[model samples]
Target: MDHQEMADVESQNLETPPDVFLKGKHQVTLKFDDVVYKIKTKKGGLLAKKRETVVKEILKGVTGVVEPGEMLAMLGPSGSGKTTLLTALGGRLGGKLHGSITYNGEAFSNDMKRNTGFVTQDDVLYPHLTVLETLVFTALLRLPKSVTKEKKVEHAKGVIDQLGLTMCKDSIVGSPYLRGVSGGERKRVSIAQELLINPSLLFLDEPTSGLDSTTAQRIVSTLWELACGGRTVVMTIHQPSSRLYYMFHKVLLLSEGNTLYFGKGSEAIEYFSNFGYAPSLAMNPSDFLLDLANGIYTDEFNADHTIDKQKLISVCKVNCVAQSKPALKGIYDSGKDQNRLQEKDSEKWPTNWGQQFLVLLRRDVKERRHESFSVLRVCQVLVVALISGLLWYKSDISHLQDQIGLLFFISGFWGFFPLFQAIFTFPQELTMLQKERSSGMYRLSSYFMSRVVADLPMELVLPTIFLFITYWMAGLKANVVNFMYTLLSLLLNVLTAQGLGLALGACVMDQKAATTLASVIMLCFLLAGGFYVQHVPNFIAWIKYISISYYTYQLFIGSQYSYGETYPCLTGQCSIVEFPSIKQIGVHFGLHDQLMAALGLLIMLIVYRLIAYIALMRIGVTKN
Candidate 1:
C-alpha cells in the first residue's frame, strides 16, 4: 500500500498520550520561502602564497512547505544539495542563509529550534552506553524539569517500543572498536535517541544509507508511523527500493540546488512522464527520478543521438514549475494563524552547570572504567617498569653514572606514560563531544572538567604502581623522607605530562597528528633534561624551562643526594663529591631548592591545562 493509506492505518494504531501531556504540544506546519544558502571556503595548500575564498552555493530559491503529518523525502544524486537543504531547514546549517523559515505561520525562534530534532548522517553515540542508558541520559538532559524522572523513563520506553528496539534495549551501542548491535539496530537506536525528546519536527539525513533493503524498509516504516502520529518529518534519502519509496507521503527532487519536483510521491512519476521521462513498470520510481535528476535518459528522450544535460535540466525545471505552481501557491499563500503564542527564548542547556558536571562525570566514569582496568594496559606498564628496574639493578652511589642513569629513566618513564595516555582524550571522542555539545546538553567547560576529574584517579593508579616497583628496585633514595618526596614529585610530574598531552590533543584534533607531535616534543624535552646533556648552547637552552622531565630529574637528583658527602673513588683515593646536589649538577640546570622544582612542576600542570581549555573552547563544536 502507498504511504497515504499506510499513514491512515498507522494513525489509528498509534497510542496517544494523555491530555495533560498534550496540553501545550501540537503539530506545526514547516515552510521555507525563497531560501538561499552558500558557504565561503578558503582554497590553498600550505605552501601557497595566498589563499582565495570562494562562495559555494548549496541551495537556491528553494520554496516548499511540509504540512503536519506528512513524511517528505528529499531525493537527489550525489552533490545535489539534499543534505544542505535539510540542514538549512533544521536551522543547523552554518552559512550565509537568505530566507524566512516559519513554523505554524510564525517565524522560527529558539523555542522552535529547541523543540526540533536533527539526526546527523553519522551515529555519534557512546559505544559503552547501553541503549536504555543512552536514552535515559538524553531524556534527563533534554526533557523539561517539569517531567518527573519516572515519566521520562516511561516516555523513553515508549519510544524504544515504537522504534522496535525492545529486544536490544539493554545492549551496548557499540562502534568500530567494539561489536554490539547490527547496522539497522544502531540506526534505530539513533532515531530512538532523538525520539526521546518527542520533537514536533524530526529531520534525518541518509538514515538508510548502509542498511539492507528489509532493514531500510523497517526504518522508513517507523518514520511513517511517527508522521502518522501528527509530527512533521523530512529526510534526505538516496536510491530507495520501490516499497520504501512509496512509504514517503511527499517527494522533493533536487538537481544542482534547484527544485525539480515537489508533490505527492505517487504523482512524482506522472509529473515526470509529462517531460517524456517515463519509468518502466519494473523500474524503481526512486531510481528513475534520480537518473533523471542526474541527466540520465534513454535514446527515445534524446532522439538526436546527443544529450545536453543542462538543456534537459532546464526543460524539466520549466515543466515542473508549470505543473506544480498551483499546489505550491496554495500551500504558501495560506493565511497566518491569529492565535500563535509568544515564544520564549529557551536556554540551550536545561540543567544547571553543577548538575551537568555531575551527570557527565558519572557517565564518563561508567564509559571508561573498563579501559582503566584493561589487563593488557596494566601488564604493559608493569612489564616495562620491571625491565627498567632489572636493567638498573640497584646501583651504588660510588657508580655515579648508573645512579644518574636511573634518575633519568624515572623521569622519562613518568613523562612519556602520562603524555601518551592523555593524547587520545579529545581526538577519540571529538565526534561524540561535538554532537552532544550541539544538542546543548552541557557547556564545553563541564565536559572538559568532568573528563579531568574522571581521569585523575585512574591516571594516578599505574604511575604509583610503576614507581613502587622501580623506586626500591633501582635504589635511588633509601631514606623515608627522601622516598616520600620523590613519590610526590613523580606524581606531580605525571599530572604535568598529562596536561601537555591534553593541550596537544585539543590543538590538533587528529590522533595520529597529536601522537606524532607528542613524540617530537617528548624527545626534545628528554634531550634538554640535564642528565642527557650536561651542557648545551644558549640558543636552544630554553627547552629546559618547558620540559617537565628537566624539573622532575632535578628534583629527584636533589632528593637523593642532599645528605651525601664525599665518597671513595675507584682510583683508591677519596674524592670530594656532592653526589645529589642540584648546585653541583651544572649552573645552567641547577635548582637552589627541591621545593622550587616541585612548585615549577605544579605551575606547568596548571599552565598546560589552561592552554587545553582555551584550545578546546576555540575548537568549539564540530560543524558537519
Candidate 2:
C-alpha cells in the first residue's frame, strides 16, 4: 500500500511523533515520556484531510508538573497538533498513551479525570438555560456539601464575574430554534462550568478558536485571571495575536509532532533563531514560530527553525527528535497497587448513587422543557388524527375491506407524524449530550433514560390528544372491544414511531442525512410492513419482520369491531353496523389482537432500544 493508505490503516499511531510512537506499554501515563504525537488521520482518502501532525514521541524527561498559578500556552500553525496535545494532556487521546502523568504525584487515570476539567472548542450548553442558570446547575453538582445552595449561587455569580460575563448573566444561551447567549458568552459558560469544581488544573482545546479577535482576547484574559488565582491552565492556540501571546507564562511549540520550543513565551524567539535561524530580529512571535514549526508558507522560510517555512519544518523534524528522559528516580520499588487507593475502582459502589443520579436527572428534566417549536409537533399529531378519523368515519360494514385498507393508513399516519418530529429535533439533543458526556459530567445511560422518560410524557400526551379528539369527531363504533383495541393501537403506534426514530438516529450522524435516512427507512418498512399488498416470495417476507409498519398495520386493522357491530358516524347515515357478532371482523372470543400488538410493540421497543444503545455506546467511546 502507498504511504497514505498505510496512513489510513494505522492513522491513529501515524500522526504521533516518532518519539511518542516509541513509548512501550509499561511507560504509559498521561505524562509524556518517550511518547511522540502527530496530527494523523485514520484513513479518509485525501491527503489534504490529514491536516497536520503533533508530537512524534512524548519526550519522557519533561516534568509533568503544571504548577498552579502558571499558564502553558500551546502555540503553532493550524496543523501543529496544538489541540491534540491538549486532549492528550487530559488523557482523552485516541490510542495507547506513553509515560507517566502524575496529578500531585498521584498517577493520573480515569479516577483523576473526575477532578480534571476540560473545555472543548464548541460551547456545549443547553440553549435553554441562561448564563447564570447553567453555571449554577453545574456548580450544584460539582461542589461539596460544605457549600450551601446560597454559596453555589454565589459561586456561579463569581465565575461569571471572573469570566467577564456579568453583563450577559441572565441572557438565554442558544439559538432561534430555541433562544440563548452569544457564542463567546457560551464558551465562557463552558469554561465557568469546568471551573466550578475548582480543579487545580484546567485544559482547553482551542479555547479562542473561531472567536472574533476581541472575544479571543477576552477569553485569554479570563484564562490569565484563573492562572493568576493559582489554577494551572494549559490551552492550544493557532496564531494568538501579539497581545494574547504576551498573556502566556510558558509556551510549547510543536511541528510534525516534534517540539520546537518549550519554556517561557518571551523566550520563544531567542530559543529558535538563537539556536541559529535568524541572525537577530523581531517579528510577530506567534507567526515566526508557526512559519518555523509548521510549513505555514510553502515557498518561504524553507528549513528547520529557519526563515523559510517548509524547510524550517523539515529541519525541525530532523533535529528536534524528542530527547529520551531518564527512568523514574524516586520510589522505584513501589508496586502499581500502591498508586491506587482502592483494589479495583469499579469493585466499590459509589457511596451515594442516588445523589449522582439526581444531579444528572435534573439536567435532563430541565432540558426537555417545552420550547415554542413543541407547538409545531402538537399541531401535527392533532391534524393527522382528527383529519384521518373524519375521513374514515363510522362507515358501512359492506365496505369492510375498504375501511380495513384505510385502517393501515391511519396507523401509518399516527406513527409517521411523530417520527417526523423526532427525526428533526432529537438529533440536536444528541449533540448536546455528546458534549456533556465528553466532559465526564454524566453517563450515557443517565441521559438516555431521562430522554426516554421525558419523551414518554410527550409521546403519550400528544397521541392521547389526537386519539380522543379524532375518535369522538369521527364517531367510530363504541364497545369495550373497540375501546380497548383503539387504546392499545394508539400506544403501540407511539412506541413504534419512537423506536424507529431512535434507530435512525443511531445509524446516521448528520442531521440532514439522518432525516433523509429516516424517511427512507420509514418508507421501506411501511411498504413491506405487512400483507397489505400481495406477499412476494420468501425473500421479501424477511422485510416484513424488519417492517415497523406491518405490526402497526396488522394491529390497527385487527383492533376493533372485529366480529360485527352497528355503528353510526353519529353525524350521518354514513355509518355501518354489521349485526352484533364476534367472528367476522377478525375478533375471536377471548382473543385479543390488541394484546398481540402490545407484545409486538414491546419487542420493537426493546430491540430498537438495544440497537440504539449499542450504536450510542460506540459513539460514546469513539469520536472523529
Candidate 3:
C-alpha cells in the first residue's frame, strides 16, 4: 500500500453492525521508538565471598510500529528477547526500561489499559469450569454495568462462535491432570476471553507454542482476521511454517536483543537476499530467518567467512531507518484522528462491589463444588463418624470419662481436618488470582470475601453430618438443648480452624510449606488442648488460650455438665462436677466460662481471616 492510502486507512473508522462483537470500539495504533530494557542480576556463585550486581541488557534499541488493522509477528529463537520486547510494548513490563511507547501518539494511561488485552503464553484458566461458563463469568466481571446480564451472556456466546469453539463450549478447560479441551481449543478459548472486552490493541505471547502446524495456522488465521477487523494485533512467535509466515502483515526479527529485520513478511526473503545471506535450498522463510539469527549458515553461503552475523545486523539497521521513516511519517500525519479515539476511563472497574462479590461467589462455588462434594470427602466423614460412634456407644453418667474422651476426639479431629484442607486453597489458585487481579477484574476485598463466603456451605455441611450421626449414636446428651449447644461449638470450631488454614495459605503461598506449617501448628494446639496435658507450665500455659482445640473441648464439657448433673459413684455418692475430667475442663465456672469459650472461638474466626485478607492485600496485583 502507498503512504497516502495507508494514512487514509489509519484515519477512517471501520464501522460494524450493532450486533457485531467489535462494534463501536476504538482502534489503536501502537508505536515504539528505540526501546531498550535492562535488568540487574547477581553475578557470583554460592561460595563466592561477595556477589556483585550486574546490569544485563534484555532488549537493545528495538523499534517498530504496528498500525491499526495489521498483525505484527515478532520472530526469534529462544531467549532472543521476543517475550521481553512484547511485554515492554504491552506496558506490562517492570524494571528499568528506556524507550518511548505510545498508543495513537499518546502516552500509556488507564484508558489505554482498558482498551488493551494481553494473553500470556500459559493459559490461566480454571480447570473445572466449562468453556462457556468461563467466558460467561469473565464477561460478567469485565463488561460494563450498562450492559444487561442477558446481553453479556449473548456476547459471550457470540465470541465462542466467532472463535469456532462451538464444538467444545461445554467442555471443561482442563489441566494436565484432567482431560478437557485440546491445546488448540484451549488457546482459542484464551483468545476469546480477551476478545470479550472488544479491546482495540491485543498482545499475545506465543499463542501457538505447543500446537501442531495446522493448529498454529488456524490460530494465526484468527489473529489475522482480528487485525483485519481494525484491531492492532502483536504476538511473539518462535517459528512458523511457510503458510503461517505469510499470514502476518509485518514481521520483526530479533537476535541477541538487536533487530535484524523489521518490515513486510512477504518481502523478508528478498530483503535478506540483498545482503548475500539467502538460503540455497527451498525452505520455510521462518526457518531460514532463524538460522541466520542464530549464526547458522549453509556450506554454499560460507565461502566468505568475513561476512558474518554482525554484517547482516549492520545492513538491516541502515535499511530499517530508510524504510521505517516513511511509514512513521504516515502514522504521525494521522495523529489528529488517533487523539480523538481516547476513551473515558473514569470507572476503575466495570462492575460494582455487590456485583463483583456475587459473580465471584458464584464462580468459586462452581469451581470448588466437585472437590468439596467428592466421594472421597463424603466417605471420609461417614467413616469417621461411624467409627467414633461405635467406639463410644451409649455412654451415660457411669461412662463420663469415655464421653469426655469422645469430646476431645471431636476437637482434635475437626481441628486438624479443616486446617489441612484450607491450607491448600490460596496456594492452588494464586496464579489465576494474580492473572485476574492484574487485569483489574475486581477488588481484592470482593475476591477474598467471596472466597470465604463460598466455603461456608461446603465447609460446614460435612461437620454437621458427622456431628448428627455421632451425637445420636454415642448418646452424649438426650436433651435437644445440650445437643444443639454441642453442635454449635463444633461448627464454630470448624470455621475457626479453616480460618487458620487460610491465613497460613495466603501468608506462605506455597502448598508444601503451608501444609507442613499447618501440621506443626495443629499438633501444638492439640497437645495444649487441656485434655492431653492439664497443667502446662506458665511459660506454655498461654498455648491453651490460643488453641482452638482447647476452647472447643472446654465448650463441649461445659455444655453437657453446666446444668449441674450428678454421676453414679462406684463406692459412694459423688457429683459429676467433682470428677477430675469435669473439674479440669472448668465446669465449675458454669455459663460464664461457656460464654467465654464461645467468644474466644468467635474472635479467632474473625482474626485469622482478617490476617488472611491483609496478607492477600499485601501481595498486590502487579505481576512483575
Candidate 4:
C-alpha cells in the first residue's frame, strides 16, 4: 500500500469502535447471611496504668437479599448501623466479617467488588475539574478498553444526561473555598463518576443526605429509574419525604443494629398498622415508621400502650421467611440460567500503568492551575525571593560573619517554605485519594509515584528562580560551576524538605494535627541546624545528622567559601585562613564530600517517600 493509503487505514482504525459484547443485562442478586462486624476500642486516659479494650459490635447478624429491579432503602435513626449494613453488602467492610455474602448464588470475591460501585455520603470529587472533565477521566480509568475513545466520551455524556447534569457540564465542581457547582450538582457529578462503568450493583450511603427536598427527590428518583433498568441498588436514608419513601421498592428498617421490619415499601405502612402503629391521614407514613423505630409516639397514638419491641421483632422475623420466598426462587432460577451461559471474564482496570500516570498527571496539572492558592503561591515565592535579595544585597566574603549569616538565612528560608507546602499535599487530597483508591481507580504506588513526578517541574521552577535572583544579587559565588552547584544544592534541599512534609502528612491524617507536629519538628531541626549553635553539646549533637537544614548550610557555605575568600584580620590586614575549607567543615559533621552531601539529600528524599508510602498503605482508606 502507498504511504497515503496506509495513513488512511490507520485513521479509519482509530475511529472504529471496538465490538462491545453485551452479556445480557447485569442483573445481580446480592444475599448476605448472618453477617456480624465488630471493632475493638480502648477506654483509658493517657496516663492510666492500665487500659481496657472493649469489643463493640457495629453490625449484628445482618441477613437479607436485594434482588435486581428492586431498590432497598435502609432506614434508621443515627447510630443504628444503617450505613454499616450497606457497606457490608457492598463488600467494602474489612477485618474479620462473620457470615457469607454471595452474588447470584456465587460467593463474594474481588470479582464481585469489581462489578459493583459504592457512593458514599460525602461527595468526593476533584473540585477544580468541570463535570465533563471529571466524568471523562473516570470513564477512561474505568470502562473496559474494548470501548473506543469516542464511545467512552459518548457514554460519559449519556450519564451526565441521565443524572440531570447537562446544564452544569462545563461548570467546575468547586469546594468550600472555591465557588463553582452547587451542592446538588456536585452530588450528581459524584454519582456520574461511578456510573461510567455501568456497575451491575450500586450501593449508596445517604445519597440525599445534604440535598434539599426537591434535589433529594430527584436523586432518589434517578435511583428508582436505575433499578427499573435491572440494576440492584441498596442505600441508607434517614427521614426521607413521603414521596421519596414510596419510590423505593423495598425498605429495610433497623433500630439499635437489629432489623425491625424488612419488606416492600408499600407494605411497610400496613405492616406497622397491623401492630397498632398506623399513621393518621395527615401524618406521613415515613414519619410514622421512624417514630415506631425510635420508640417515639405522638399524642394521637397511646404512648402508654406503645407496641412492645420484642413482640414487633417476633412479627418481623416470621414475615421475613415469607418475604424471602420470592428472592430464594429468583436465586434458584438464576442458578439454572448460569449453567447454560458462558462465564465472562471479570472486568479489570482499563488503563495501563503509563496511561494511569499520564492521565493523573494531566488532571493534577489542571487542578493545580485552577486552584486559587496556586497564583498566591507563585506570588509568595517571588516576593520572598525579592525580599531576600534586597536584604542581602551584594554580600561579600570580606567579612566571614556576613557570609555565615547569608548561609543560615538561605538554609532557614528554603527549609521552612518548602516544608509547609509539602505538608498539606497528602492531607489536602486524602479524602479524594482514599475514595478513588477504594474504587480501584489506581494503585497507591501509581498515584504517589506520579504525584512526585508531576511535582518536579513546578517544584524546581520557584527554587531555580529564587537561586538565580538571590545568588547573583547576594554576590555569593561568581563562577559558573560554583553557581550551578549552589543552585543544585538548594533544589535538592527543597526536594528533601518536601519529602519530609509528605511523610508528616501521610503519617498524621488530621491537617491541624499534622501542621502542628510539622511545625514543632521543623523548629527542632532548625535549632539543631549548624549556624544557630556553632558549638553543639555532645548530648544532642546527633540531631545534626537528621537535619536537612544542617546539610544545606554546609553545602551552601562550602560551595562558596571553598573559593578561598580573603578575610580582614584584627589589625586591618588580610588573613589567608581563619576558618577551615568548606569540604573540611563538612567532614567535621560527617558530610565528607559535596557529592556525599548531595547524595545524602537524595537519600533523605527516597527515605521519606518510602515512609509516606508505607504509612499510607498501613492506614488504608477509612470508611468513616
Most TM-score-accurate candidate: 3
lDDT (0-100) at residue 212 of candidate 2? 93
- Residue 511, model 4: Cα distance from true site in angstroms: 2.3
lDDT, candidate 2, 398-492, per-residue tens: 55555666666767776676676556444676666666555555556655666666566677777677767666555555656775677677777
**Distance (Å) between predicted and true CA of 547, model 2?**
3.7
* Regions of model 4 farther than 4 Å from truth: 1-25, 43-50, 299-306, 329-336, 339-348, 371-373, 563-565, 571-577, 580-592, 622-624
TM-score-superior candidate, 1 or 4 = 4
Q: Rank the candidates by TM-score, best first.
A: 3, 4, 1, 2
Q: Estimate each model's TM-score.
A: 0.88, 0.77, 0.91, 0.90
* Residue-wise C-alpha lDDT for candidate 4, range 464-560, written one tens digit per residue: 8888887788777689988887888888898999899889989997889988998888887878776666677889988878889777877776676
Counting clashing residue pairs in each candidate, in order, gives: 0, 57, 0, 0
Which ten-residue region of model 2 has the weakest summed lDDT? 20-29
TM-score of 3: 0.91
lDDT value for model 1:
0.78
Model 1 TM-score (2 dp): 0.88
Better of 2 and 3 by lDDT: 3
- The C-alpha RMSD of each candidate to the native structure, in angstroms, is 4.1, 10.0, 4.5, 10.0
How does residue 56 of candidate 1 score in lDDT? Answer: 87
Worst ten-residue run, lDDT, model 4?
13-22
Off by over 4 Å in 3: 1-21, 45-47, 301-311, 314-318, 321-334, 339-345, 568-578, 581-588
Clashing pairs in 4: none
lDDT of 1 by residue, 310-402 (tens): 665566456655555554456546634422425653555677778778878888898898787789889998998898788877776677768
Q: Write the per-residue lDDT of candidate 3 for residues 16-46, one digit (tens) a residue.
A: 2223336678778888888899999998999
Q: In candidate 1, how many clashes are counted?
A: 0
